[model samples]
Target: MKTLGLIGGMSAESTAVYYREINRLVRERLGGLHSAALILWSVDFAPIAAWQAKDDWDATGRALAEAARRLEAAGAEAIVICANTMHINAPQVQAATAIPLIHIADATAAALTARGVARPLLLATRYTMEKPFYRDRLAALGLPSLIPDAADRDRLQAIIFDELVKGVITPDSKAAALAMIDRGRAAGADGVIFGCTEIGLLIDPAELDLPAVDTAIVHCEAAVDFALG
Candidate 1:
């Protein structure tokens, strides 16, 4: 098995999920004592969050690139960013290493396409929702994207950073998110993309009427496929 390199902790909550899911998948697939051979470079989200708040993507990119390089030097065969919004710097991270960077958005888009979802509502941080990086990826896959309105977007972002990242799950926040999903459905979204890694921790796809894609799951599955191959 190839060694999977994970650049995570853009909020340790979701990073933990990625780690758990990846190992769980490997164990379930290979059975017995089999598990993923992996390395992880978990970053402090405070500085990364500050850079994001100030729109300092260059710094963010540099930091992630450095992390990728370190992982590659440590014998990682592939890289996984483990966060949807941080994918804006995916190119930089990929450039820093000879190994592949398994992109969360690309994996999610592929899954949506395979499921015949042409229009999916994206629920993520404000940066990911407003940025062209993610939407353009979906468009390239022949899938158009929908996002919440300004008010709802702010509410969602707040819940993610202020609550979800901190491991605080509230019924009120789930209800608000469900309302936004309903609005997206009304606006012609046939499916939902949990674009933020932390979203899966809050909402269960089984409860939603529309099909939902959990990016963390898709991304981890892709990594597992790559590793085992």
Candidate 2:
């Protein structure tokens, strides 16, 4: 298997999910205790979050580009940025490395398309939801998406950063998220996109009425496919 480079630790929580899922997929596919051959460059999230708050994406991109260079020098065949919000730096990382970057949006878009979901309600951090990078990428892929209203977007952002990243899961937050989904359904959403990697921890796709695409899962699956090839 080719070594997959993972740029992670936007929050330690979701990176754990990516690590576990990627290894599980490799074992399931190869059998006999097989696992992924991968490298992880886990950054300190505090400064990264601070930079994001300050809207310093240029610094963000440069730092992640450096990480990509290190991973490439360390012999990674491909790179995966484990956080959805950090993909804003994807172009920088891609340019800094010779290997492929397994993009979360591309994986999620493909999954949504595979399920015949023309329009999915996207649940993510304010950066991902409000920013044009993610949505514009999906639209370019021929799958437009819906985000919650401004008020609910604020609530969801709080739930993600304050609760989910800290490993807090409350019944109230889950119910509120469901209500947002219901509102999206009323708004004509045909499916759900767990746009945040950590969202799968809060909302299970199995419980939703609409078809759901968990970006973390599909992203891991795509990475595994690349590694195995």
Candidate 3:
């Protein structure tokens, strides 16, 4: 199996989920005696988050690029960034690494297209939705993505940064999150994407009435395939 390199700890909230899903997938596939072939490089999310919020693309890209290079040197077969928002700098990071940087957007785009979801609602950080990087990539794949309205975006940002990013998940927050997702569904979206990596903390497929896409899970699925397949 190839080693899965994780550039994780972006918010730490969803990094845990990524690690768990990868291990779970490996165990389920290999059965009973297996953990993932994994190498993890945990980043200090606060500093990175601050830089991202400032739109400091240079510093943000530098941080991820450094991580990618180190992970490559550490012998990761392929690297996956653990956060959705951090992919804003993925181009620079991928260039810094020798191995493939498994991208969440690409994985999700392929999944949604395969599932016949041409127009999906995207629920992520403002940087992810408003920025054209991810959305343009989806467009290139002949898929469409919709961001939440201003009010819903603010709500999602709060749930992600103020609560989920801090490792806090509550029943009330979960309900509010599902409510926002419903709003997106009502907007004529075929399915809603848990585009914020940390969203797995507060929501799940079973909890929602609409079809859902989990980007972190999608990315992990791709990583596991590359590893054990």
TM-score of 2: 0.99
Compose the digit string of candidate 1's lDDT tens values, residues 1-229: 9999999998899899888999999999999998889999999999999999999999999999999999999999999998999999998998898999888887998899887788999999999999999999889879989999999999999999999999999999999999999999999999999999999999999899898999989999999999998
Give residue 63's lDDT in candidate 1 (0 to 100): 97
Tens digit of per-residue lDDT, candidate 2, span 4-25: 9999898889999999999999
Candidate 3 TM-score over all chains jointly: 0.95
Clashing pairs in 2: none
lDDT of each: 0.94, 0.94, 0.86
lDDT of 3 by residue, 1-229 (tens): 8998899988777888898999999999999889998899899988888998888989989988998888888889898999888888988988997788888988998888777787899889888989999888888988788888888788778878888889888988888777776777778888878888888777877666667888989999999999987
TM-score of 1: 0.99
Per-model TM-score on C-alpha atoms = 0.99, 0.99, 0.95
